[model samples]
Target: MKKTLIVVCTLFTFGATAGTEDSGNELSYEHFVHSDKPIKCLYGYAAEKVGDHDAAIAIFEDCIARWESVYAMIWLAQIYDTGIGVPQNLEKAAALLKRGAHTQDEAGYSSLAKYHYGILLLEGRGVPVNKQAGIEWLQRAADEGVDEAKDYLQSMP
Candidate 1:
């Protein structure tokens, strides 16, 4: 009976230690998708959800700069532009959108192209007001199957 108890305790201790180590080694989005820093974008999102805009902005920016992932860049741009978790910076947003548009990520391309093109047309940001061009890009986004693009196209004047 003593031997059986010892064996059970050893197994329990080993399992607990192994589980703790595994949790410690678990990869966050920062480790898995972003850079070595703890700049997990989902962490940023969670922070934003809890109204920790400053923390969220910091994490989002870190994720964007560390990974340069299209999605990360987009989120960073959004946060900056809308003042979600950062100060509104239209220039930065446009720059990020341009970066996304120039990249090969189809989803990124569709999103950035349509939004930047449309906003530029409506607000005359960096480009000339070219409503037709905006429409064409939006159509391309819709054809590429961006959900917002389809809705935007359907709502177009």
Candidate 2:
């Protein structure tokens, strides 16, 4: 753990959420908490941004359970992958990416998880080295217009 953070404080921060929605930022208070006071995926980001990875993990798990938010899954995967304030768990991270891979958000955007999962599959990190499957995923990501995926595919021999 990076620092000891009170769970209550984290709960309060999530509950309060702090302001109106900004049009440009997806990570906004309004996105996390509405007048109905439902906890959304962005609540995890809020907690994480405030340096409470534990709280963020809890919130992301809850979001995944309650709403099946792909965004939450992806963010949580990143957290697990990077080991921010926690031990790196590539298996868990890869699992999250796989779970989120087929989901598209409101904007019809996806492929982010596919690319990461593809790389992990290729590296045999947390998963088996399934080169064919990895290449397929990379292809899917490239088809979806992920430049990084396209570049990766092109760079390969």
Candidate 3:
């Protein structure tokens, strides 16, 4: 655990410093990783938005391992699914989405996760096509206020 923390901290420190003026700031990445609140987990999104996928992947991987963060899982899943900064791996993407779906925290986040997982199932991206299961997941997402899921369900045949 200590080794992992050190590695994660190093990654975060470099990522945090990149494109920032804080060249010599003594920022403690461990504090964010160990914090009870997960405010810093969203940094991966900024990395993703700026096309720094390597940093995003590292940050999101940290978030999932440390906090099981829903958004991080979803973002990483997309990166894998789309081959963004890495080779496409549908199975990996689906697996991450599966974990996100089973996550008990963050209900709204789970809804979005379920919606994405349902699409993968419906399209057989990495798993066998199970329309019934896909529809069920989509329905759950719709019930939880996922607008895209509602639209998908409404447009279903």
Error of 2 at 155 (Å): 1.2
Clashing residue pairs for model 2: none
TM-score of each: 0.60, 0.72, 0.76
CA lDDT of each prediction against the hidden true structure: 0.56, 0.72, 0.75
Error of 1 at 152 (Å): 1.8
For model 1, the stretches where C-alpha displacement exceeds 4 angstroms are 1-39, 106-117, 125-128
Q: Which candidate model has the greater lDDT, 1 or 3?
A: 3
What's every prediction's RMSD, in angstroms? 12.8, 8.8, 8.5
Worst 10 residues of 2 by lDDT: 29-38
**Candidate 3 Cα deviation (angstroms), residue 76:** 0.3
Candidate 1 residues 7-115, lDDT tens each? 4455345432221222332433222232344324445554455576765666667766666656556656666678765677777776676676555653344365556
Which parts of model 3 are misplaced by more than 4 Å? 1-37
**Predicted structure with the largest lDDT when compared to the true one:** 3
List the candidates ranked by TM-score, beginning with the highest: 3, 2, 1
Candidate 3 per-residue C-alpha lDDT over 1-157 given as tens digits, one digit per residue, 9 for 90 to 100: 2433554566566665333333244243333333334545655665566686776787788778888888788889989999989999999999999889878564357778899999989999988999999999899889988889999999988
lDDT string, candidate 2, 1-157, tens digits: 1111453355466564443343444453334433222344556776687787776787687777777777778888989899996799999999999888777766323577788888989999889899999999899989987788999999999
